[model samples]
Target chain A: MDEPPRSAPMSASVPPGGGPGRIDRRAIVDGFPLFVPAVPFGFVVGVAVVESEMPAVVGWSTSLTIFAGASQLATVTLAGVATLWAVAVAALVVNSRHVMYSAALAPTFRHQPTWFRWVAPFFLIDQVFALVALRPDGSPASFRRYYLTLGVFFYLMWLAAVSLGMVVGPAIPTGWRLDVAPAVMFTGMVVISLTRSPAVVAAVVAAAVAFLAAGLPDRLGILVGAGAGVLAGAVAEARLVNDRAITDEQEFTP
Target chain B: MNMSTAFVLTIVIALGTYLLRAVPALLLADRELPVPVQRALRNVGPAVLAALVVVSVASTADGGIEVEVAEVAALVAAGVVAWWRRNLIWSLLAGMAALWVTLVLV
Candidate 1:
């Protein structure tokens, strides 16, 4: 996907250059560890497809077409037995969190090309969002390179894992505890993101609410908790600004 | 379900999901958001990550939330390593190790 150093107009948005090759390499390295947990999760989705009696091809195709694991699991598991609308709604609601991810990323995507904007969201999974959101100041060119490289890497990895799962899924014992890996990965991600006090507030509040509302239907608690945490963090930030302003005024008056 | 029925359902779900994801970027492209919205968006990463942590580890049981001891051990170990080393791979390894050790002992 390298464009051979285009003219100034096209390349103007490029940051004080990381060299396209370097950024792609860095993106792959950064994405590798995060991508690890998805293997077992994909296996679960594959097992769901087998149990549902869906065609293996159709089950595998969802990995490419839908690309979101949770919803894919829901859709595959519920497809035949559930009402058509029920299956659709269940999957869509599971994926509704992507709306927030998209909104948060809109500003970064603002300066991207028309084609990039159109194609980029196709790969907007949780890991991609977390990685891009970490480097909010990246240039449009770098952003495109990093996002696509990482996206494709994850896509290929997921496809392979799910395929492997479909073959041996039934034989694998559930007690192997493949599930613990993703929880650990997510915990590490949360720790990495907690660089500021207000961010800590956000994480804590979000965790508390999500745990309390764990029974919410269709995973709506995820959204509800996240929204509350954002509000808490924003409120904390506004208060900090006000307090600093007050202290500054007092010093100036004296 | 028949292959054709599953195929049609897959297409429908995929289309709806695509719109949910793509519309925000297309509509808000290049537009500056309000200050409050920006502040909230800033926390979206941490907040969502935290929520995901809970979703992964906690599930509804017969009547209430049931969290496994091994998973919680994994989370604490991972959190400490992540904070101390600031490395994802190390933290992940630590958490997995902790999970297995706790499972064996318990």
Candidate 2:
């Protein structure tokens, strides 16, 4: 099948009622490419989940229940070794970054129908959020179709890839180092997602913070580090905006 | 944990994740957030993903500090491609291809 649409068609064929909403072609096509890296990552998760010795039901269930590669792997891996509380905490901390995405997406979701708002977050993974944030225009209108298309597209791809990986099973050796897929995927996403100077600053700060906080329990370091980076980026962004305002005023002096 | 316990933990974690995502989209819907807040939130994507990238590649399968050289090289390759192409599939394919070459040749 053709990949999900990469961008909203400048002109789409939506019928009736302020544009009759079908699943957005742009979103569907665009969303699937982001799934490329996740295919390997899902395979790795599938293998790891199996190795964790959980029953097949529990193992496969996570792919649907969590719908996130990293956090699902973290939770499954932790289950065998850590206490349930520790596992939950690690998973929660891993998922905490979604809070930032959620807040960032709030403006877009605001205009969406109540039912859409209720269900969309279920698909709010890093890839989807990055795609939304990178839009040049950043308009909230018509986001529902884009968001829904991306979500549905990603959900099916992830589910299929992971389930396939599980059936392929542990025959794939660790020496292959397939575990690196998530980092590779995320690295690509990060590079493409960066647009402004503050974004660059934020990435650097976040990496430094994560490195420093490495020993924190339950993988809480990611949460703390992400927070620090955002705060620093905000400061930088604010300063830049202030400086730009001053320059504009000076240029316009009458 | 047993299957039942593991299942329950997964459910709880799922609930926590859903709420984290839902709360903001629900509460902050239909209004312009403060500019500073919006600015901060905009950068959150880069910050969080960067952090995850580091967290993932910095540790080994056994949780050691030593990361594989091939994996690091592959990740760098992927990042460069992503930046240069600005396309997800191309970068990922480039990364995996680089990884294959590195593992085979290096």
Candidate 3:
């Protein structure tokens, strides 16, 4: 795969739908990259559910049914009084990015059927979205189909890992080892995040803020850090773009 | 909460989570966002992920701020793996290995 150019213009021409020949291959090819990360993360989440004193079935069902890893982790980790509300809020916040992901791909997917449209969103995880969005010439239908293929594969992997972890929960030694899971997951997220322009500064600033505010109650520090990072990145982008516009205008002046 | 209550809570939480994950895609299905707003949304994932990582590493035993060398080592290893390969599995493996080594040695 070639390294994508920094800011290539999106293709206005709509490519033919993957039909049967290309869509299946595209899905499998794109989906394979996601499986590796999902397994470890799923295992960790499974372990977390057991640690929370919840039944192993709950973990398995949650992973199998919901299939949203970050939200699942946040929900189980903070499982306490009014935990339902907290999980709801956190999941909403975390998944808010999907809207952007879907919107980015909408132009390509404008031709897909409503049924396909409705079902495609459920599988719109970060990896699926990234793969589809990065495609050189994928149409909306192709993107949706590709995402569903990835989603199905991911869902299966997640279910298997969670089940394995839940079944073997007692045998897995407890301690610092479990901590490695989140660290690893978060690290991958951070790296992917860093590839984009403005996120580097945002991540650094948010890390600093989170470190300072780590004492806040009920994991509010995470919220604060996230909010700060978004605000920082938005401000930076706004300023940079504004400055560039001014420079361009000045250059164009008579 | 009691076992039954916790079970109910878990169910509620699970449902709530699904709703959140689904809502954004559902709402923005066919809608087109302004360029500026779209750009802002683009940064959300990275920002949120970074915040999560910061909190995870900085979070202390008593819920206070404290930096542990092991955690720092893990973070660095993870960052290196991610930057070098851009592969999630390798990055995670590197971080986990770093954490395990640090834990055993320290």
Worst 10 residues of 2 chain B by lDDT: B59-68
Give the per-residue lDDT digits (tens) of candidate 1, residues A119-196: 888889999998887664545676777787778778889898888888887778887688778878988988988887
Question: Candidate 1, which segments miss by more than 4 Å at Cα?
Answer: A1-23, A246-254, B61-64
Write down the lDDT that model 3 would get: 0.62
- Candidate 2 per-residue C-alpha lDDT over A100-157 given as tens digits, one digit per residue, 9 for 90 to 100: 8888778667666777778888889887887776654333345656666677778888
Q: List candidate 3 segments past 4 Å from native.
A: A1-34, A37-41, A47-59, A70-113, A124-137, A175-178, A246-254, B1-11, B60-62
Q: Indicate the residue-level lDDT of B93 in model 2.
A: 74
Q: Give model 3's docking category.
A: acceptable
DockQ of each: 0.62, 0.59, 0.42
Q: Which predicted model would earn the best TM-score?
A: 1
Query: In candidate 2, which residue pairs clash?
Result: A3-A29, A4-A28, A4-A29, A4-A30, A5-A26, A5-A28, A5-A29, A5-A30, A6-A30, A15-A20
Q: If ranked by TM-score, best first, what sequence of candidates would result? A: 1, 2, 3
TM-score of decoy 3: 0.73
lDDT of 2 by residue, B1-106 (tens): 5778778888888888789888988889878667677778778888998887777666444444556668878888998999888877778777877888889887
DockQ of 1: 0.62
